[model samples]
Target: MTDDVQAVHQPSDLRTVIMTGASSGIGAKAAATLAEGGAHVVVVGRNTARTKEVASRIGGTAHVADFDRLDEVRDLAQRLLDENPRIDVLANNAGGLVSHRSETTDGFERTLQSNHLAPFLLTRLLLPRIVESAGRVVSTSSTANLFGRVRLDDLNWRKRPWAGGWLAYGTSKLLTNMFISQLAARSPIQAYAFHPGFVSTSFGSDSASMRVLNTLTGGSYGISADAGAVPLATLSGPTTVGVPSGTYFDQLKPYGRQAPQAKDRILAEVVWETSSRLVSIPSDL
Candidate 1:
């Protein structure tokens, strides 16, 4: 058997967790670990077969929906909420870095749509259930946010030409941070952004720019997917306390000052408003 199929503990009392990008990488590892911890994890991904495989092996349910597709993400959230109103955790982990400039069916930038908009929409859609259950919302961020620059004028890369995938990817992370801050202020759900610490995942191998970065670093800088899952899993635990909402973390250690762009409330609100218009949710939901 592959090493990736290693057994982990399941969540006992933590019965419900909605994990996106559960097909592979840190998301998959986190889903397995949480399932082993006894949580009835709902795995969401673009690929049905792989996500189903992970869910089946972990004794959890799988839901297939592409985050890059806003309508799909919206539908996924509604269906998930309908299936189980007791969802206790929302792990917004699905994201990607397209090598070239692209847009989703919603006409939004692919990275922004997947990493920011979809998560934003899904969280808003499922927030009532999460808050009803007094659950936490954990979104994945990266150290790349440190170097990210938000091009507000050209958020879609319409004005500026495609520089590289990393630039757009980094900006998306920054947007995530900004959104988290707004959530902390507005939502009852504890919101946070975490750096999984240079994860060694297929994402890097799949992108030419990341491949070069990985090779230059001799792969020494990357952490195992399980290692990255440690801190994420911690946030989902019941014993965790005093976790400052909107804070950034790296392996249980609190990291700070992601980037100037990440603190732009105006940008965050703009993104939030734009996202709200894209998805249809009940007035208080």
Candidate 2:
């Protein structure tokens, strides 16, 4: 942990939550809710000022790292491991919709790397501590996953033309669902993915059309960010809530409709293996 990172003093028994994307939208709201409920929240975001602001408001610790770079993700993980004795819940809530096709410094498609690969790496690196704490992993997925198609051969989008990035975004969410399912199957840690509904957030603010639509429609088009955050905060709670491991939720409802590829166990296993290889982690971990 850095000296400048604000640390909130909380009860030792409080659950330690690491909330990514806590600088804004559903993630920020959910992190506040968790903190109010007496959890020790670790706020992670790409924007330093925004991340620290949220953390300061919630009396939580803040760390900033851009998901576009794998090195930053690794550094964030190490800082997390070094500071927290246990991580009870990891809310993989940091992701966005890229409007154009681009590759990160890590050499993976920007959307796929930011939304899936980065979270994948963070979870795997923290697996041991999370398992030791008998923790849970809750990811923010989407109904857009219904349109996703994952091709193992073209995971990097090197061979296919980008369909304006929605396809890539959907594919990343599908990978999220599959990763949760496979993680639950292979490990004792409870893992879940959920669709937060069409939230009125800056999710697709990278696109000009989306910005215009959001401006014109406002909150009428979708639920508020706090409303969309309810499911995430709920699922982040105790395991006794009866949500089974590997469940994909549409808001609060379990077993939400998922794409065929998202539910295929064999394909999920392959995805797990391939993602592990891509991120240079152990497949079996």
Model 2 residue 176 lDDT score: 95
Q: Model 2: how far is 262 from its true place, Å?
A: 1.2
- Cα lDDT computed for each candidate against the true fold: 0.78, 0.89
Error of 2 at 218 (Å): 4.4
Highest TM-score, which number? 2
Per-residue CA lDDT of model 2 for 1-285, tens digit only, reads 222356444454668999998899999999999999988899998888899999999989998888999888988888888778888999999998888888998899999999999999999999998999899999999999999999998988878778778888899999999999998998998999999999988788778767778779864678899999999999987546586799999999899999999868899998888889999988986
In model 2, which range of ten residues has the least summed lDDT? 1-10
Model 1 lDDT, full chain set: 0.78
What number of clashing residue pairs does each candidate have, in the order they appear?
9, 0
Q: How far is candidate 1 from the true structure (C-alpha RMSD, Å)?
A: 4.8
CA displacement after TM-score superposition, residue 241 of candidate 2 (Å): 2.8
Where in model 1 is the C-alpha error above 4 Å?
1-14, 213-221, 278-285
